[model samples]
Target: MPEPEKSVRRQEEVLRSVNPVLRGWAAYFRYGASKRTFSYLGWYGWWRLLLWIRYRHPHLAWKQLRRRYYGADRITEGGVVLYNPAKMRVQRYTFRGAQISTPYNIDEVDPDGARFRRTNHDDVAFVGQVSEYLA
Candidate 1:
């Protein structure tokens, strides 16, 4: 596998670890796939699983998904940020030119990881970072 593909797969894995319920729903709904595609499930058991997650862990639902930004000033180009999107916002930190907005009433903020899983999410559009950019 190429380097870019590896990063993409890694991103999917990170997302799954942070939000398994949403990932499973996406997999069943034929949406989130790194290499292979999935189709809708017709089984009652699968529907039951979805319902279980929905009622038990309502925060992980698709509609309630929130994007949490983290600061990674030391991360390299290909690094990826992974965090639970359903977490509440606290302090804010800037990373690699991305601005993280914060609340106004708080003082002495640390901008720690929302759920202890945040990382740097770098943006690279080239197939080969150096080769494509230099060409």
Candidate 2:
């Protein structure tokens, strides 16, 4: 592959790693030489996986699929930030420019991952608010 082509492929790999399911399914749809056209399969696969990614995707950069909450400073250009309250630490780590998988907050004051996953589910808490911007 040319240098640019290699770069694009590497970028795709990074993206797919962040969002394993959508990218995995999209890779399945593509065939032969057409698989190189990652863009085409990407669009369709995201639709299938957006809800999963938004509400419940795990592992920002870690590919083990371990259960946890993940996010990016920006959906477009930031690295993944893994949040795990059980561990009693909110780590702002970097996972490159993969798709953003922000975690939802359950408590108004104590926003934590496992707590958010359990005792609360306010869709509005996660969207269309100043908090989302701050997050």
Candidate 3:
């Protein structure tokens, strides 16, 4: 059985350090009666936290301090939030596409291990270094 009240307050501190909206979103997404529990509200809060982190605390994207302490990716810049997996969550997974960015890889393998490549891609080029923004 899990220990009672060992949940710690460090996450609350980190959440407090962030913006109000991000903090609220993280609380709504990452905290619950059960870790496995999730709903549309939780997912929405998750997305908001990520954007918040990406825009505010980009440093966390690499070695996420909040994630390390809380074992959750409940916050991010510009408020795009996500539930960082820990414990049993490793057995469950979900994938989401990004709107502001897309994979740049020109080649990838299919689920069957067949190689496939991208072609006739748009000539439209975004003119800034994506890394710098995150940095």
Candidate 4:
């Protein structure tokens, strides 16, 4: 119960920080029960805003979308956005096909030779320096 509340609060904070319009829409949509009987204008408007953002602001929308791929071959210059910090890992790949040669964490593997940088945010980490090991 508390976890869901925390998640909602975090989402509200991010949305408010990014755009106050979204915060207002979220508030109205969540509490517009009285207005829901006549028309779902608030609900419809929120979905439209989300779709608009998805197409017009892909980079910003990426935070809402998620993808998972194993190994270094899939690693991009943008690096990996680890939503779950518990899965922090260093990936080493072969130069030929860019396939992973090894996958390890700080505890299991020494990062001296990996050449990576980990940037932590509220609940996610943007790991850069992928080319060093993938090269």
| Predicted structure with the largest lDDT when compared to the true one | 3
Model 4 lDDT-worst window of ten? 80-89
The list of candidate 4 runs beyond 4 A from truth reads: 1-34, 60-135
| Candidate 2 global lDDT | 0.38
Clashes of 2: 0
Per-residue alpha-carbon lDDT of candidate 4 for residues 1-135, written as tens digits (9 for 90 to 100): 455453333333433343445334444444333334213443443444455445654675454432322322221224322122112232333353212224334344344444542334532323234445566
Q: Root-mean-square deviation of each candidate, in angstroms?
A: 24.2, 22.9, 20.4, 23.0
- State the local distance difference test value for candidate 3: 0.42
Q: lDDT of each model, Cα atoms only? A: 0.35, 0.38, 0.42, 0.37
TM-score of each: 0.16, 0.19, 0.22, 0.20
Order of quality (lDDT):
3, 2, 4, 1
Predicted structure 1: clash tally: 3
Q: Give the distance in Å from residue 132's predicted Cα in candidate 3 to where it truly belongs.
A: 86
Model 1, 24-46: lDDT tens per residue?
A: 54444442232222122222323
Best candidate, TM-score-wise? 3
How would you order the candidates by TM-score, starting with the best?
A: 3, 4, 2, 1
In candidate 4, position 82 carries an lDDT of 15
Of the two candidates 1 and 3, the one with more favorable lDDT, higher being better, is 3
Better of 2 and 3 by TM-score: 3
Show model 3 residue runs off by greater than 4 Å: 1-38, 69-135
